[model samples]
Structures are given as structure tokens and as C-alpha cells.
Target: MTNLMETLVENREMVQPNHANMLDTAHGGNVMKWMDEVGAMSAMLFSGETCVTARVNQMNFERPIRVGDTAYITAYVYDSGTSSVKVRLITEREDLRTREREKTTESYFVYVAIDEHKEPTTVPDLTVSSEEADRLRREALEGENGNC
Candidate 1:
């Protein structure tokens, strides 16, 4: 079983002008792309197989990340089913000059492992390794009323 704490995945992307909109803020599409990529990494790490996005739960942009900021995205497997892995993605914007960070977005995404034929493949069960990990998993489940 993959432990939630150890299964967490993180990636960073430098926000460029091209990645932003006319408002000089990071585009929503770019943020979604980062979330999807990070979520897929977490799913693959937990499943030990290639995974594709199955569904994206409520993705809300809490704040706008301006261009020239660094986007830090972290994802972890919070729950799992027969072939699906549920991942929670959190995004924060870091001011490179000031070394400050602000949360920008959060979303829950589901990924399904797939075989060469693109058929769904099984994923191992998730295990919570620490109190914090257990709490996070519980909170993620409760966020969706246990639907996740």
C-alpha cells in the first residue's frame, strides 16, 4: 500500500507572460494544467501505472497569481477505489523576490490507471502513515460527503 504522506507529489512552474492573461495574472487554463499534471503524478506514484484524468471536482481559484510569480503545486493520493485514485491538488503562488507565498487554488481530481490498451487497471489501496496524513484523508472525504 502507498502511504499518503510519502505519496505526495510536488512540482513548480515559473509563471511567464505567455502563461498569463491580459490582466497579467496567470490564466485559469494554465492553473488547471498544472493541477492535472501534479494530480496525475501522484496517481501514478500510488498506482505504479500510467494514469489518466477521470474527473475533476470543484476547482476554485481563490486568488489570482500574477505573472513573474512561481507556482508551487502539491498533490497527494487521498483515497482510492478499484481502479481510480483520488488526489487533492493545492496551488500556491510564491513571490520570488520576497519569498512569500499565498494560496491560489484547490481542487480534487480523480485519475484512473490504464493499461496499454487504454483499459482501466487496478490500483493498490492507500494507507495513512501518520496522524496528519489520516486527518488529511478524512478531511478530503468529508469535503465531498464521502463521495470521493
Candidate 2:
């Protein structure tokens, strides 16, 4: 069994000009790509194998991230099937000077573990070891605040 807590991943990227949109905010595609990468990291950790994105269930961007701000991303394994790992991803806009962060986006992605031949493979069972992990799993399952 793999503990959900062990598969958690956090990443941060400073928004650059190339990653910005017309309004000088982070582009929606850039943000989604970042979230997908983080989600894949979590899935790979949980599966102990290379994983490929199979689906993105829901992705909602609630706020814009300015070019100077940082995109702080977090992801964790919330559930799994024999060959698929389900991850919850969250993105926050972090103002470095003010040292403040605000939730900007939330999403759920499904990844399939792949073998050396690029065929789908089984993943170990998942478990939540702590109260916080349990809460996160519950929230993901419940689709609380429409973040699913």
C-alpha cells in the first residue's frame, strides 16, 4: 500500500513574461500545464512507475497570477484504481514581497501507470495516514466548494 501523504508534491514557479497572458497575468494554459505536471509527480510517486495523464476531471481558475508573482502548486494522491491514480491539485498565487498566498485554482487529474512498454500497469493500493490526509481525500471526493 502507498500512503497518500507520501505522494504529496509541492512546486513553485515565478511567472515570467513568456508565461503571461495579454493582461500580464499568468496564462491559463501555463497554469494548467503546471498543475498537470504536479499531478503527474504525485501519481508517479504513488504508482512507483512512470505515469501518463489520462484525464483532467475539473479545473477552475478563480484568480489571476501577476507576472511578478509565483505560482505555488500542490498535489497529492487522493484515490486510485488498479491502473489509475487520482490526484488533487491546487494552485496559489504567491506575492514574494508581501509573502502572501491565495488560492487561484483547483483541479483533479487521473493518471495511468505505464510499464516500460508503455502499457498500463497496476498501481498499489492507497491509504491516508493522517487526519489532514483523510480530510483532503474527503474534500476531493465530496467536491467541496466546487473544486473537484
Candidate 3:
């Protein structure tokens, strides 16, 4: 079994001019790409196998990440089936100068573990070890009820 905490993955990216859209904010496509990368990492950590993105639940962009701001992307396995892992992903905009941060995007990604032959494989069960892990799991489940 893999603990939910063990599958946690966090990545930081500085929004550069190339990543920005016409409004000088990070492009939605760029953010989605980053989320997918980190989400896959979390799923691989939980399954101990290469994983491919199977589905991406509705993605909500509540705010914009301006250029020069740091984008903090976090992902963790919240649920899993025989071969699929669901990861909760959150993106935050952080101003390094003031150290202020706020969530900007949130979504859930599902991945399936695959073997060398590119066939789906079973994954270990997920375990929540601490209060924080439990809370995260609960939030991931409850958050689905609201508009993503």
C-alpha cells in the first residue's frame, strides 16, 4: 500500500513572457500542461509504474497568474481503483516579493498505470496516514460537488 502523503508532488514554475497570454497572465494551456505533468508524477509515485492520463475532470480557473509570479502546482493521489489513480491538483499564484499566495486553478486528473507492454496494470491501495492526508482526501471528494 502507498500512503496518500507519499504520492504528494509539488512543482513551482515562474510565469515567463512566453507562458503568458494577451493579458500578460499565464495561458490556460500552459497551466493545464503543468498540471498534467505533476499529476502524472503523483500517480506514478502511487502506482510505482508508468501512468498515462486517462481523463481530466472539469478544470476551474478562478484567477489569473500574472507574468513574473510563481505558479505553485500541487498534486496528490486521493483515490484509486484496480488500475486507475485519481489525483487532486491545485495551482496557486504566489508573489515572491511579498510571499503572498492564492489558489488560481483546481482540477482532478485520472491516470492509469501501464506495464512495459502498454497494458493496464493493477495499482496498490492508497492509505491516508495523518490528519492532513485525511483532510485532503475529504476536500477532494467534497470539492467535486461544487462547480470546478
Which pairs of residues have clashing backbones in candidate 2?
none
Model 2 superposed RMSD (Cα):
1.4
lDDT of 2 by residue, 1-148 (tens): 9998999899999999999989999999999999999899999999999999999876778999999999999999988998999888889999999989999998888899999999999999998889998998998888734655
lDDT of 3 by residue, 14-78 (tens): 99999999999999999999999999999999999999999999988999999999899999999
lDDT of 1 at 103: 86
Please identify model 1 stretches exceeding 4 Å from their true place. Answer: 146-148
- lDDT tens readout by residue for model 1, 1-148: 8899877888889999999999999999999999999999999999999999999998779899989898999899999999999998889999978989998988889899999899999989899879999998888878656443
Stretches > 4 Å off in candidate 2: 144-147
lDDT rank, highest first? 3, 2, 1
lDDT of 2: 0.92
TM-score of each: 0.93, 0.95, 0.97
**Collision pairs in model 1:** none
Cα lDDT, all candidates: 0.90, 0.92, 0.95
- TM-score, cand. 2: 0.95
Best by TM-score: 3
Prediction-by-prediction clash tally: 0, 0, 0
